[model samples]
Target: MWLYAGRRIVLTIPILLGVTIICFALVQIAPGDPIQNLLSPTATAQDAARLRAAYGLDQPLMVQYFIWLGKVCVGNLGMSISDNVPVAGEVLHAFVNTIVIALISVVLAFVVSMIFGVIAAYRTGSLADRLITAVAVFGISVPPFWLGVILVIFFAVDLSWLPATGMGASGSETFSYFRWADFKFAIMPIIALALPPLGIMTRTTRSSIAEILNQDFIQTLRAKGLSEAQVIVHAVVNIMPQAVAMLGLQLGYLIGGSVLVETVFTWPGTGYLLNKAVLTRDIPLLQGTILVLATAFVLINLVVDLAQSLIDPRLKRS
Candidate 1:
């Protein structure tokens, strides 16, 4: 397991580097010059030239990339052209916010999926099963932004059950675990972000449980007079490794999707921060945000791989 984990960890470096290269190239080669945008509208050609030199934009592309890469390695993400804030500070702060939102969303998704999945599998072709299936399908099909708007209109606008914008009450910067207002503010966005993954997980769990039930061992257990609950639990335990692996990957997707959901809901999360940075061409913040996200995804995949090996010994064998 250690060897496998080490291999996975080693592989993450190149994958992250590749992502950086592609993102950097796209940002650099894209049609707008950050320096040009920063200058006065009536500025002379020499003004543009000085701004270019100031930001080292006049250097060769490769040289510029190396300079940026060096800065990144040493923990300097560069300054935001728009705000002049340290890139690391802004990105790290946004990342911490994103993590809080992502964790809540994952917990909600897992709990909801497990309950519905077990019900659908146990009830099989009953009306309850059909309803669960339909709900899952709808959850999976709906775009998060659209869902966010509908939720805001119904829950926030009409009912006034929750706040429609921001992470918390207007001036509350630091979060509090015991605050009802903060929790209520987080719910709508978490629900919208979690829906698709919850749906997918429910379907996967239902199918996996059903398949396990058909196995000879399950039939033998039934013949031996095992209770249905006991049998189901045993089957779920056996297939849980695969389900866990699926959850890991899905969690990564959920985190990424939260960006869009947060944007639509006007929630203050890493996703929303990244979107704002991109619009304003905050290169340092953009690079930091994307790198952090990619790193998280890679780490999630690695953890899942290790978990699979632990759950199923055969996975670690030839």
Candidate 2:
């Protein structure tokens, strides 16, 4: 098990390097100069050239990449051109915000989806199953941003039960833990981030469970006089490898979706930070943030792989 985990971690090195190349390339191709962001409207051609030179933007792309890569290797995430502060701190802050929202959202989505999926599977063609499946389909189809807007209008503005946007209190900048006011603010955004993935998981679970129920072992267990509930509980446990694997996939989706959800909700997560970075063209900040998110994605999959192996020891042998 340790060896398998070690192998996965070692493999992430190349993937991380490739991610850096792709992220850097895409950002470079994007229009709008970070230099333009640096200069005032009245700045002259000389000033533009000087600023470019100062920032080494005049250097070949490859050179600039290597320079940034070198700094990244030494624990420096580089400085924000706009604020001239260490990008590491800002990136870390945003990373924390994202983890808080993403973690809760992922777990809640996974558990709820499993329960709903099981209920739907049991009911099969009944009205209850139809309603559950329809809800899941609607969740899968609805764009999270639109859902977020609707939720904000209905729950925050009209009902006044929750705050519309932002992650903190009247004066506090970010949420550290569960505080009633900020937690209330987070509820809507979390629901927004969870729904799409939850919907996908529900559909997948219902299908997987249906398949498991038809298996020979399930029939054998039924023949042994086990109740349907007992057999289903066993089947659910047996089917967990696939469910856990899906968790990794859904987690990736949820993290990516949080970008839009955060924006709509004005949540102070990495997605919101990322939006600001693009507007200001904070290259180093963008680079660092993308790298961190990529690292998280890889790590989440690794953990899921290990979990599968643990759940089904045959996976470890393979």
What are the per-residue Cα lDDT tens digits for candidate 1 across 150-260?
999999999999889776654336766458867788788888888888888889888888888889999898999999988988888877787888788787887666778
Residue 40's lDDT within candidate 1 is 85
Best by TM-score: 2
RMSD of 2: 1.8
lDDT for model 2:
0.84
True lDDT of residue 4, candidate 2: 83
Off by over 4 Å in 2: 170-174
Among these predicted structures, which one has the highest lDDT?
2
Q: For candidate 2, which ten residues in a row score worst on lDDT?
A: 168-177
> lDDT of each model, Cα atoms only?
0.81, 0.84
Quote each prediction's TM-score: 0.93, 0.93
Number of clashing pairs, model 2? 0
Please estimate how well model 1 matches the true structure, expressed as its whole-model Cα lDDT: 0.81
